[model samples]
Target chain A: MKYYIGVDGGGSNLRVALVDETMHLLREVVRGKANPNTLGIQQASDRIQQALREITEGFHEPIRAVGIGISGAPKAIAEKWLRDTVKAVLPFAEVVPSSDEEIALVGANGERRGVLVLSGTGSIAHGANDAGESLTIGGWGYLMGDKGSGYWLGMQALEAYIRHEDGTDTRPTSLVERVRQQCGFKDRFDIIPWLYQPAPDSSKVARLAPLVLEEAQAGDAHARHIVEEGAAELALLAQTIVRRLHITQPRYAFAGSLLTHPTPLAEALCRRLRLPAPPQPRYTPLIGAALLARLTVDPV
Target chain B: MKYYIGVDGGGSNLRVALVDETMHLLREVVRGKANPNTLGIQQASDRIQQALREITEGFHEPIRAVGIGISGAPKAIAEKWLRDTVKAVLPFAEVVPSSDEEIALVGANGERRGVLVLSGTGSIAHGANDAGESLTIGGWGYLMGDKGSGYWLGMQALEAYIRHEDGTDTRPTSLVERVRQQCGFKDRFDIIPWLYQPAPDSSKVARLAPLVLEEAQAGDAHARHIVEEGAAELALLAQTIVRRLHITQPRYAFAGSLLTHPTPLAEALCRRLRLPAPPQPRYTPLIGAALLARLTVDPV
Candidate 1:
């Protein structure tokens, strides 16, 4: 049987999947972080090789193509290394190496023809048109952009708490109390050390997003305001993508914990974007990568 | 003849001054960073000791007291260590230990009875009343507060640049070209590695404040708006201190490069606060520390 292999390499972990021409998942394996930036390109390559060997061990099928979507492997050097590694494993297979975001976008839409708004620790909007033109908006990370992201919401909550303490914001917010409880802050100044002691951790700050959402749902005006602002910023991202892509009634899919789950932030974002509902992703990123691999060998 | 010693220890450098009873500066010495947070308490103490020894070398007059204002030496342990270090250097002298901000406030007013607004890499307003009652507001650092600080301004500039690049912000501003020229960015995505590669440096971000100020003065609408917002926040800080202290017309002094220098940000701040002009500080923070030392020995 002819087969295609897909690999999803992220910062925290890696996933390898094998599928037939029909796009049916035949085997899948998971491993540790395979991000070339974090784990040197050599180590990342080794991990991918091991995963490929394991996934293709029992099957005597010829793999026509291999697709890899790796975080921090978008640069030319890393991409070259990835392609070469796949070639060494499956000499006859065509290699299609892309970024994790690209594979996710394609996977989320089940094709290369929709917009995907991701609001994880950071936020970004990626869209592709039928003509193969693609555009990305936002995703400037925690410092510059990521306006409607988890980090942004959590930061807003903390800012509100500080303003409340300083009497600079007298708008009244339950966020002060909620954040204090969540962080176990005995004193308001405790936040100083918590944030700055070992350097600001974006993931740690993003974790507070859920509390903000909870407070919003509990009818806290301040929290609700924060959520609305975040939603509006996120909506702007999607709107900007739709306009730039010139896609009418574009299919929008949501990624990240804050958007995939049912929450006030998600609801507000959908309402602002006029999305009736969050569209379900047709396939996992792994499957999407496999499809991309198949497309490389047999163009449709 | 009797003398008082004042030491100002900061993240970058340390300044020590010897003053007579009349607060006349006698001898002064400068050294490297003496902040206990960056340099351990022992090393910080050693730096202070070396500076003190040099400043008092030729003066045989009895040293009545020593005043010190060191960054990150506010904790009881660090404070106690600082006091002991001073006592060890001049056993007969009384030791008065306080934070850099407190000393700056007293130094700027030449007494512990006015408000001081500082807007460097971070921002804060600290005030002291005749009753010895002191209040502090808005020194939450870059993440949570420091709304009107240089770091805040630079961050806003970068955010604007990103928005402008992504076509999210259509506002006409010269910040894009300024930032590009300043950072030597070939592509907009170059900012990603610049910010996240070696971790976000608040000081490096703050270094961009001047470009924003220059653009604001040159009549860039976006840059002006950012400056105005920053100035408004700073004015709020001063106003809050005034109201809380019940000082009908308190003496206000500005510190930090952004405020101490003549810039659009400083001008807007003075205008918003209704100050005829930026008030000149009566003494430097080192002299303020000496004054505090004097106050400890002879009240009034």
Candidate 2:
């Protein structure tokens, strides 16, 4: 009996798994970051290779296939490098490569035919219809897009705090105090220096998203407005994907901290999107990658 | 005859003028940039001193006073340093230091009152009422504010182009092709790399503002909306300053490329913020600085 290999190369960590033909997980291994966009291709490939080796150790039979889903690795740029690296590691196996978003979609639905909306440090809604047409919206990063994301919420909170400090804002918000307490800012305007630093970290800003939700939960109209607006933006992404794919009421799944965490923002998104109910992912991204590998080798 | 000096230390260049007691200009000199906020205090001071020396080279009479309106020099931080530096340069001169905004107001109205709205690389509305009370709105820089400025218009244009390329934007615009021709971009998505560089230059992005105005002139609905929104925001700044300062029909003056340039955006701003007519600045910022110096020496 031959096993299959699947890798999920994320921004923070690299995850690899060995699975049987029936999609049963045999073993798993995790390593450091492998996001090619941030971590150069060489480092990402090294980590991917390391994870694969650890996962397939002690196996005599050559793996039948290997599939990879890497963060920031679009098909045009990452496909060749990822395929060659996987082949070098497992000479006998066929390789399938794709973007992390695609993997997330395949993983959540156990197939590539449903929508996956993510609202973590950034946000995007990606999906493909039965006709194999895919569409994406609202993943334009913090500077250009990523509306209704954690970074967006944090930016909103910061803007509000600034307006309040400026003494021009009419809205009453405890968000100023909450942010000061959370970030340990001695002065209100201190947030400016922190934000304009030479290299502002997106995740550090995204972390502040919780404060907005906390204030909203406590009935702050300003914070509530931010949440509602974010939810609407996310909903627009889903609606756009569905309409463009020409799909009728396609199954939708959620991913990332902003959506998965306990917050009014997530609930508001659900309500605005008019989703029938909250849906759970059917399988892990690794499992989905393995399934994709199986499909690549044996297309029915 | 006693002479008063006024200096306009701008972001791009320095202008110094020797004005007599009656505000009649004696001699004017121009030099390189001396904005202390970006150029260190020492460099800025050096440039200021150089300009002063160049302007008063042949004059033997000790200047009676010096007034400076400098960009990036808020009174709270720049007061002591500027005063000390000017005193060191002109031993007998009484020195007055003020922000560029204040100087702009003084220069535009030939008085210490009325609003001065600027829309250059960044945007801000600043002025003082009859009561000597001053208010400032916007000018939060490119990252957080400056919503109605040239940089903002450029950013908006780029966003529109990206969205249009993504096949998600509802509006059809030729801005994509225009931006490509103007920016020398080979691929549609090449803007991503340019924007996400290690230290993205705000001025470079701001330089794209003219392109937006060009498109707007040709009657692109999407471009028109951006211009209108920008105008409304600038109008809000004027309104905020007017209401906060408790002035009725305060004389409003415009400065910077977004306002000074002949564009629909400037026209829109003028239309949205109704006034008697387009008001010209009574004097240059350097003259305003001299006037301020005179006021310091002789109140009222």
Candidate 3:
């Protein structure tokens, strides 16, 4: 009997799983951030090794392969370094490494023949054609791009709040009060110190996306406009991928909190894309990593 | 003859000038950044005092009055602290402090009666009516507003560059190459580290604004679009001020590099606002600070 190990190394946290050849998750261990970009290579390697050792120590069976889906590890050098590091830990097993987004696409559809739009802290659209050729759009991070992302929504909300506070925006919005209540800010100037002092956190700002959605549901025109625009931006991302890949009636899998929420952002996105129905994700990206590991040793 | 010290305390640098009642700059000294928001109140005060002492060392005349225009001194507390600090340094001088925008308006129009649109690292529209009542429209800093400012333009250019880099945008732009050359960055991922590592500097990012202008002048459709959008946003700022203040075809004064540049951004702004002519600046903000000091002693 053979087992496999799969690791999901992301910006926020890391997850490692022990799985059987059938791609069933047997035991999983979660750790803090293990992205080599944020955490140094040594730290990331140590965390992955620790997870692998802990998960396999209880089970004496030799693992067939180890697969890792790391955020920001798509480049050749990054992949080589990561593969070498993972190989060092599980010397007997085959180590395969890929980008977090690629694994997400595989996880969403069980096969690489659909589009996956991940809209968590940042946003990206990933698609794979029937021939297994893959492409990505709009995962450029927060500084340059991340349209329709959590950070984008938060920024739009902040802009609306500031404009309203200034009494310059003729367009009415309840965002000032909503944001003030949400952020626990008593004065408008408080936002200035809050945003700049701590060196803006992407996740911290992304947390405000739900506030915008909530306000939109409550009938705030500005909030609704932001949601619509965010949906449109995200729809454009999906549309671009679909058109570029020449996929006919591609099935779209929704990922991240923006789509999973009770808000209309996802509905608006699907409507903008003119999809016939909502597509459900087949599995989580972690399970997708496990599936990829299964395919490494036992390709059918 | 009595001398007045005029201080223009900005985010990037500070300028101090010893002037007579005629508002002619005598000995002038430039120092490092002195915005109380960026530099603490103590450090900002020390820099301002150092510049004042350096400029007035050779001439031993008692300064009758001193005027200061600080970037973030509009708040009552900021103004009071600055005034107290200035008074402590110049015991015999009557100290007056105002927002940087107010002094810019006074400096550009030669009086406090017209609108001044400043589009530097940040942007704002400030105006003083005939009743000496002042109102401001869009000085909400970089995070919330400053639509047509250098920082805004630079961010737009970066967004365009990222979109083009991702192949998500069909519109061709030289921004990717132009920005790479300007920033001396060989890899695309370098921008992420450069931006978030040291806490993003608004001015450093703003330095890229000229590249967008250069690209636009060279006829890049994407760059041109960004410039046009920026111009329209700025025109809205000006229009808001005009309607709120009930100014009839108000003579508009332009301050800062966005408008001062040879690009069509300013012309576009003016055209959008339906302005017939560009209002010439009567004096620099330093002289405007001096004139404001003159007013402190001899208010009409």
Every model's TM-score = 0.96, 0.95, 0.93
Interface RMSD of each: 1.1, 2.2, 2.1
Model 3 lDDT at residue B229: 92
Rate residue B241 of model 2 by lDDT: 83
Chain A TM-scores, all candidates? Answer: 0.94, 0.95, 0.92
lDDT of 1 by residue, A1-300 (tens): 578998988546799999988889999999999877777878888999999999989788788898888876663436788888888877877899876667777777777778888888988887777777778788887877498899999898888888878877788777888888888888756888899878888989999999899999999998899999999998888888788778876778887778888889889999997878776788877887888777667877
Candidate 1: residue A25 lDDT (0-100): 90
Q: Give the TM-score of candidate 1.
A: 0.96
Residues A140-212 of candidate 2 have per-residue lDDT tens digits of: 7778758888898988887787677555576788887787777777764466568876666778888889999
Cα lDDT of model 3 by residue, B156-223, tens digit: 87777667656677776787789878777776566776776667778888999998888888888888
Candidates ranked by TM-score, best first?
1, 2, 3
Residue B51 of model 2 has an lDDT of 82
TM-score of chain A of 2: 0.95
Residue A20, model 1, lDDT: 88
- Candidate 1 per-residue lDDT, tens place, B85-170, comes to 88877888899887777888888888888888889999988887777877888988877759889899999888888887888778
Distance from true position, residue B69, model 1, in Å? 0.6
B-chain TM-score, every candidate? Answer: 0.95, 0.95, 0.90
> Looking at model 1 chain A, which ten-residue stretch has the lowest summed lDDT?
A71-80
